[model samples]
Target chain A: MTTKRSITVTVNGQQHQTEVEPRMLLVHYLREVLDLTGTHIGCNTSQCGACVVMLNGEAIKSCTVLAVQADGGEVLTIEGLAPEGGLHPIQEGFWEKHGLQCGFCTPGMIMASYQLLKNNPHPTETEIRRGLEGNICRCTGYQNIVKAVQDASERMSTSAETPVPAGD
Target chain B: MSVPAAFDYHPATSVDEAIALLQQYGDEAKLLAGGHSLIPAMKLRLSQPEHLIDIGKISSLSYIREEQDHIVIGGLTTYVQIEQSDLLRKHFPLLPEATSMVGDQQVRNRGTIGGSIAHSDPAADLPGVVLALKAEIVVQGPQGKRTIPADDFFVDTFTTALAPDEILIEFRLPKATGSTGSAYDKLANKASHYAIAGCAAVITRGQDGSCSAASIAITGATVRTIRARAVENALVGKQLSETVIAEAVSHATDGEDMIVDIHGSEEYRRKMAAVVARRAIMRALERI
Candidate 1:
């Protein structure tokens, strides 16, 4: 018999202290435990980026991370990107630029782009393509996705007074 | 959803504590560093140890500092950290260059230097880089701490010299002296981004414009990472030109078992290894 470990993870801005199975993955903990299903699990083999999330301010695939491994760590999922109702700038870009055809890869794509634009405010088209190389959108050939990121970069870079970082 | 088999998770905060846990669990325990490589295997039910001593939070075991004549890097330093480090860029330029090409952005954020090297994955890039730089691996067990040369550390694919009770602590890389240059080249498999053929070269030039010292190591193409001593011997004391480097790197797969996987064939990889080795050597030469 295996014992359950108690872990506390700060997701978005809310604190959730829960008991989980030792083998439970972070994505499972989010979806099944905390009910944050924004982070998807496409391949489960770590090849696809559908499970990407911001763990301690760095992007990592949630399926590859154990719930116990993320003990005391801060996680920012797609659910936490904006307040309850409205969309974040990157999400707005996707909606405005038609970045998604089926929207399966949007959450992971947005979370990844959130980090990329945070790190490099003004990313070139090549940089955007490189930044999103891990994500796969089977519906769109990614021409519009690149435009969506470019659209977000301009929106975030221009709108801020005194240059407040987009994702901070 | 694939899940790991039920196992006890022991989070150790110190090296001594982790070593004690290892002694307690014996062969049933496996140290979980970044959990990138091990987790996937566990999910596939390939590596189901009875216990996992979590050592990722051993805060002291993650750093990159210089002590005397050597550059000391702790085992848990992430590839992204190594890629952005100014100290490594100033002292060891090849580390940053090699790290930037390791994996995609998310993979690099979690995979650790010590974890990748200890796993000894044939497709992993850092193994060949460490072997090329001739770094020393530091390991600690219940008995005491010991250092092993990079040449001897990686015994075979998915294997290392570390016993079940010993944990990799850090790597001690000798600071390159004089005008030294190093590079890594590979033909990456598209989906996994792993090398079908990878070569890493470190060369130091003498004041006479000849090769003073050379260390070349290969991965992905072979069953294990092996030192290309014949290629190294051919370059020393010779003025390295395109023709000489081409001739020297021709012995890249002289005596080795080439890996044949779905990603590539033995014949294809053997041919790619030579071309990749020449490119790596030529790039190193250009940097000098």
Candidate 2:
């Protein structure tokens, strides 16, 4: 007996209109309806950073946000980080370095790092570690992840990275 | 498995509409601000409100500025905003300091200060911080607006003085004058980051080099955020030496029930409470 509400969200620079049940979470909407399964739901609760996404220029756990709550808002997910045939600097950093052991937490880690590096272009190792406190990597032990973020910070600052184009 | 029960979603653009929705739905409704706390609880089926009145998008109710002699903060201001606000930083740096300790980067980006205090989780930092600063809580309902002092606002754990039909709209803090300094310290659970022991202290230094007015509050060690009056009484009208401050903070848990949970045992929290309170008070004095 769920009522569906009409909502529109711009995700990864593309706008789509849909109707969702009030109980639907933003993470569920992304994985199920939009077919953007890159945004993992590790804990399903807000404790895990696996569902982190950029909502209105700041990162937030999508699992805790209702689908209808994000109406008329813009969201950036892990898949939208780079265009076709190219890897974003963060993804490149992870690729160049062994940033993942299981890769379950990579997307979320990269998304969270995107916001962190955006706020502070050049962060120290301690700052990078503190930035990833919300994201838990049970297997990898975070040594390489910190290196990956540091690597991305250097690459991003090396040149003025272009903002992801909207709906290209 | 962590799905919330079906409910109606109402996005209120203004304060009046939010209050009106609260009156209309009564007990079956819950106010949604930032949705950081409410939705998490809902996912566990701990709370199943039939209507969710969302006030997170109210632009007019999201601000930080000086009004008259008071620093007025809108109810919808997020933790990240408060942590980055130059106004709050210049005047009340303790707020920003405590705000940074709330959650990780993502949580701080979305959790609102008003929502945190309204939830009044015994472990939350803002309740103790506001109590130390003596923030005036403003609420609105069908009967109109009234201000409640922070001491009377938090009734118990996960409860506040807000009526079913009332919505908290603002928090007003008096402009601190003279040699006033404040600080916050907390021992948080490494994984969850909830406070295991947290203390906030606001102190005013007198011209005589003695402590003038002082307030200290402790959280995560009690059933609710409580003003450590014993600690406050011991510090006032005295030179704040290390021994004097240490003796004062040793009473941080006097006549209080320390919460026993997975994070800590009763005795462990009792011990850590005094440690955090002492550190917070000492840091406040250094600033003064």
Candidate 3:
């Protein structure tokens, strides 16, 4: 048996120090060790984007990445998208646009979309489709999910020009 | 699913350190790059190495630069980098176009170019593109650094010319010359993430609007990406016309066994290869 290794990872802005088996995946580390279960494991294989998370500001499928691979990386989960009392524009767009039917793929879908918009804030419809292509939503037929990204893009653009009121 | 087996993890900071680890563990050690390919295989018990030499952290092997006669891309450069690189887009548009269509956003973020070539999966999109571009794979071993032409680098399905202790460090794509253009098209399987059939076409148009030189490669229709010599022979010195392009497409899969799987049948994939080859050639011709 191989010995576990001690590593430090920064997740959602908090430093997490732990000793884990060499084989532990980042998805398992987030769910089991840190108790951030928002990242679901739908396919365990990298095929399903259900385990997507932002490692060092880039969206990656956590299941394919070893926890040790993320030792010195900064990670962001769905829980970190919005800090207090409110949803991010993407989350709000999903709620308003009805982007989810089962909610299992929401965290990953949103995380992938988050990275997309972060990199290309104003993507065309075809570009948006390609951007979210990695993320799969078995429900809602992806029509509303595409609409949500459009809605979120508009909201994010509008918010950038005029900041949202602090308390509402 | 749990990983197949427990393995010792060694984080190598430099290429020398990685080589030493590989030499120490021998065939028992496997280099871990982005882990987009190996980890999934390990999870499915397709591969079970006793030691994982983690070379993903070696920062030196991650770069994309333009050289005098070629584009030097570090093997560890991720798909996301290729997709976003303005340097690659300006000189090698085919690379970014193909990289954008790879597994998906998250997969592109973690999958490295080096790992993809090293994996040498027949259905992989980049291998065909690299072969069409006539790229070279640079490897470092205990002996020294050597360059393997892309055609020679890919020997068979899921295999390369890399030895146990040899590490692929970079790929060198010959610079385009004289109204040159390239493109890649693939019919990807939604379930398996492998291309059902893919084609990459690179053409150089002469002053007379005729083909100066053309290189065509097809993947997923065979055990490995192979140069469509028949197509190239038909295309060279011919006018960039629909008739010639059609003839070239017919010869796209001349001497290969098409892969038949859940995604597509042998006949369908063969036909798709012809179609994709024609489209890629036309797209490349238009750019030229």
Q: Predictions ranked by TM-score, top down?
A: 2, 1, 3
Whose lDDT is higher: candidate 1's or candidate 2's?
2
Q: Give a tens-digit lDDT track for model 3, residues B24-129.
A: 9998989999998899988887898899999998889999998899999999999989999999888888899998888988899889999998998898889998
- Supply the TM-score for candidate 3: 0.95
Reference interface contacts recovered per candidate: 0.86, 0.84, 0.88
| Top-scoring candidate (TM-score) | 2
The TM-score of candidate 1 is 0.97
lDDT of 2 by residue, B108-138 (tens): 9889998998899999999999999999999
RMSD of 3: 2.7
Q: On a 0 to 100 scale, what is the lDDT of residue B268 in model 3?
A: 87
lDDT of 2: 0.90
RMSD of each: 1.7, 1.4, 2.7
Residues A1-168, candidate 2: write the lDDT tens digits.
657899999999999899899999999999999999999999877777999999888888999999998899999998888887789999988887889988998899999999889889899999998888899898865998998888888898786765554422
Q: Compute DockQ for each candidate against the true complex.
A: 0.84, 0.80, 0.75
Error of 1 at B67 (Å): 1.9
Model 2 root mean square deviation, Cα atoms = 1.4
> Candidate 1, residues B9-73: lDDT per residue as tens digits?
99999999999999999988888998889999999999998899999999899999998989999
When summed lDDT is taken over every stretch of 10 residues in candidate 3 chain B, the lowest stretch is B187-196
Total backbone collisions, model 2: 0
Q: For model 1, which pairs clash?
A: none
